[model samples]
Target: MTLAAKKKAFVELGKFLGQFASSGSAQKPDVLCNDPFFAGLENLIHTAQHHNGWYTPEQVFFAVQSWANALTPENLDQWLSRYDFAEKSPKTVALILAGNIPLVGFHDFLSVVISGHKALVKLSSNDQQLLPFLAKYLVAVAPKLNDFIEFTDGKLGHFDAVIATGSNNTARYFEYYFRDKPGIIRKNRNSVAVLTGKETREDLVRLGEDIFRYFGLGCRNVSKLFVPKGYDFKDFFEAMFAYGDIIHYEKYANNYDYNKAVFLMSRFNILDNGFLTIKEDTAYGSPISSVFYEYYDDLSDVTKRIETDRDQIQCIVSGVIDYSVPFGKTQQPELWDYADDVDTIKFLQEI
Candidate 1:
């Protein structure tokens, strides 16, 4: 398929999904939640609910709608149309997905499928349903795609290229396993924030979303913050209180309780909200449910510090900068926002 044709197919898929965004719910989101195969995704939601963290059919629907909306041709043109994929097509592509966030590897999956390559996908147990659902729908929209995409639970054998995402530790494993192949190896990365005194009350609340959404398990989640010196911590505290509902998750609550106790036991005077932890640090990443904060003497200095670490960061969500939307929405990405600084389409074309 040409770039224009692929774009059209994706837009059609997006529109079809958007139609369900209003009132329908996924029948079974779980069976396919960790498996990227059409068989598992056929009826996914209900079967997966008992596993962990509450995710309703309605929420899953919206998540799909949000993903589809972002991938529509219009949005794709805005964020990702720069990469032309007509020339490079891999004979085979292996994709390893991250389950930390839902549908995290969809773009890569689409890039491979659209390029007419056979895909070998290893589903993330944390996020199993999305890819298969998408694949099934793609086959429905364009039957030819069926011959191109395949989901698997086995090893990626004899693939011409590979792309894998995992923690820093797992990255080492992928480096050894796929070392001989042409591929991109991504490691554990955490996004951060640089807060200025000018932030408004609403801005702080959005920051809470950036921190609390998906229980802060996503790479895009802000695990740390840089506050301008003398910045009133009260603003952040009050803002986070607005999202008190997020603390209801059993796992999240447990994480907070455990971490908080550990802090007190060790005489760590870290700032916390019973949901997040703050401390003096120059790092960008944090654990699933904790946040770290450091006060900076100057705003420019903080920016410079972060710019130096930009290569290590995935996305920067901030209240002080003039950017699109607000915080918690960082993971609710726009179309074409490639993850880990790798453009899948471009990679496909290069091969």
Candidate 2:
């Protein structure tokens, strides 16, 4: 398909997705192929938690809505404007996805398709249905797309290049296995927030979203916090109360109980507010149901330290950090906000 055709197909998919936001879902009369897909997607969104406990209806809807907001014509146009799409013979690119969050690897899939390459996708077992279902929708929107997408449950084969997202350990194996091929292999990355005591109550409230969304499983979720020395948690804890109901979710409650017990057994000092715990630690990746915090004596030193360990961090959330995304916005990444800051389009085009 031509670039224009591909963009049109995606914009249609976006419009179809736009109908299903976190608040609720409704079918749009103008969306193509809704008879076949609309209800199926709704069922998937509702029952996602049955397949993976973390994929609650609320979380699944948020993921769907996030993509809906991203795949618009204006966003696609601006994101693609920077690229040179001079047509070249299509190559088969293998996609090894991460299922930690719903549609976690869809961007890579979209990148391969829009860059005019065939995709050999190996779906993450944890998230098997959503992306393939959308791929079907894409094919329905533009039948020519049928020729460009394929899914595999077994070993990937005969692909010229690859893009893989996985934990740090899996990333090493990917690096060794795909060493001969041009590829983008990603490892574990965690996001953090830097806080000043001067932050407004509203800022802390939104920061709660960064901490608790996706149950803090997504890389974009803020797993750690940087606070000034002697900072009090009284106000921060109060703001986090907005998400207290998150504890009602069985899986998250189980984690909170288990991790809290483990922490107490180790005699580590932790601040708990019934549902979430905050501990003093100098680490980026924290377990679910908890967030790690470190005391920073100077904002400049913290910024310098973050820069030094840039690859380990996926995003920095703060009003103060010059490069940071504002609180609560980390998970809502634009198409140009590539994972690990790796430009998948450039990589695909060059390959």
Candidate 3:
């Protein structure tokens, strides 16, 4: 399709989504659920929440627009062209999605479909709605593409390609399972920030949002911060105080309390200043109650260290250097970027 035609369809899709966002309902198909994907989404959201999974409309908007813009035909085509999808068509791919954050796996799903391949999707229990809802919409828009996509939970037997995302342990499982197949297996990757004392209150506030959103369960959540030694924690804490409400997540709060108690009892090296807790560790993971902020002697050297560790990092949020946008917002990825650090269309074409 021409870019113009695709954009028009996207505009229509966006309008439909906006209406749904406002009405706060998805019962009727011709309305918000007109796309089959949304219908599945409605059912999925109901199921997810029913089973202790939490998703917000704001997160849904983040997912929808992120998918809409990135997976649109034009953008998909551009990414495909970079790796030559035209020469490699009809690849069958099995996608194992991650649900740590809302709709984290949709981009891989889109890459396979838009590149004209068959997708064997294994849905993550954490996220069961948006992908199916989207698949239905795509088929509705172009019925000719129906057989190109399928959703299944079975073994991805003999599939020519694979894309999987999971934790470090699960990455091992994926590597063993799909070793023969050409694929990309991504493990946990966390995003971080380097906070210079020069940051304004506004920047701190936004940075807090990046860290706290989704209760900091996402891979892109700012799990750690690099700060200059002797930095005044009060200034940063004051700006982030509004997000104290995030403590309401009973499970998350429980984690915080548990970790804090353990640290106090064991005399573990940790910093606590009433609200946020700090610990020093080189691991990409962070505890629920607190984020780890380490002191850096020199900004440039520390930035270089982070660059060396980029494989473990998803994106960095900072005022000093250009980085991909912050976490929570990472789900709303743009058209150009690829997820799990893999090129989608290239894999699809080969299949």
Candidate 4:
């Protein structure tokens, strides 16, 4: 299929996704191929939690809405305009997807197909349902796309290049296994927020979305915080109070209880507000239901430190930090906001 056809198919898929939300699902007759496909999608959205505990209807709806907002014609055009797709031979690109969040590997999948490459996708077991259904939808939109997509359950083989995402240890394995092939092997990376004590109540409240979205599972979720020295967390805690209802989720509540007990038994000083915990930590990755924090003397010093450890960080969120993502926007990455700061489309074109 031509690039225009692929783009049109995804735009239609986005419109299909727009029908779902935590509050309800609505079917618009104008959406492409709405007959049985829309009904199937609605069922998937409602029953996603049955397949995965973390894939609650609300979380799944949020993910769908995020993608719906992203896959507009304007956004797709802006993102693809910078890349040149000339008379290039299409390669079979193997994709090892991550399932930490809904459709986590979708950008890579879209990049491959839109770049005129065939995708040999290995779906994460935890995320087995959504993408394939969407793939079917795309094929229904543009029958030619059927030739461009394939999903594999067995061992992956016969691919010209690879794109893999996994934990740090698994990433090492991916690097070694795909050593001879052109590839992008991603490892564990977390996002962080820098606080300057000047944040408005609204800003911090919005920041709660950055922290609690996806139940703190996605790499884009703000897992760490950097605050000025002697920062009073009273306002921070108060602002975050709005999200206290998150503790009602059984899995998150379980993690909160377990982690809190472990911290107490270890004699580590921690600040808790029943639902969330804030503990002084130097590390970036924090446990679920808790966020790691560090006190910084100066923003410049923190900037220097972050620059040194850029690879370990996925996104830096702050209102004052230069080039940092704004608060509450970490999870809503634009089409051009490539993960690992590596352009997937460019990599696909080159390989």
Instruction: Give per-model CA RMSD.
Output: 4.5, 0.8, 3.6, 0.8
How would you encode candidate 1's per-residue C-alpha lDDT over 1-351 as one tens digit per residue? Answer: 555666666776665555444365343342212234333442454444444354544445546667767766668677554755555434888899887655668877877776667788889877776677777776766666777788887766667899898989999999998888889888877778777778878778888877776677778778888787777787788888876766676766887788777777988777876666776665667555567778888767877776777668777777565343366677687656667667776777777
Q: In model 3, state the lDDT of residue 29.
A: 42
Worst 10 residues of 4 by lDDT: 41-50
Poorly placed runs, candidate 1 (over 4 Å): 2-4, 20-43, 52-62, 87-90, 319-328
Deviation (Å) of 129 in candidate 4: 0.2
Superposed Cα RMSD, model 2: 0.8
* TM-score (all chains, Cα) for each model: 0.86, 0.99, 0.84, 0.99
Show where candidate 4 strays beyond 4 Å: none
Task: Give Cα-based local distance difference scores for all models.
Answer: 0.70, 0.94, 0.69, 0.92
Report clash pairs, candidate 2: none
Candidate 2: lDDT of 236? 97
> Mind giving the per-residue lDDT tens digits that candidate 3 earns over 246-276?
6665666787888899888988788764556
lDDT of 2 at 89: 98
Ordering by lDDT: 2, 4, 1, 3
Pairs clashing in candidate 3? 37-133, 37-134, 88-349, 90-351, 91-351
Q: What is the Cα-based lDDT of residue 335 in candidate 1?
A: 56
List, residue by residue over 1-351, the lDDT tens digit for candidate 2.
799999999999999998997677788899888998988999999998889989998999999888989999999999999999997999999999999999999999999999999999999999999999999999998999999999999988799999999999999999999999999999999999999899999999999999998999999999999999999999999999999999999999999999999999999999999999888988899899999999989999999999999999999999989878988898899899988999999999999
Candidate 4: how many backbone clashes? Answer: 0
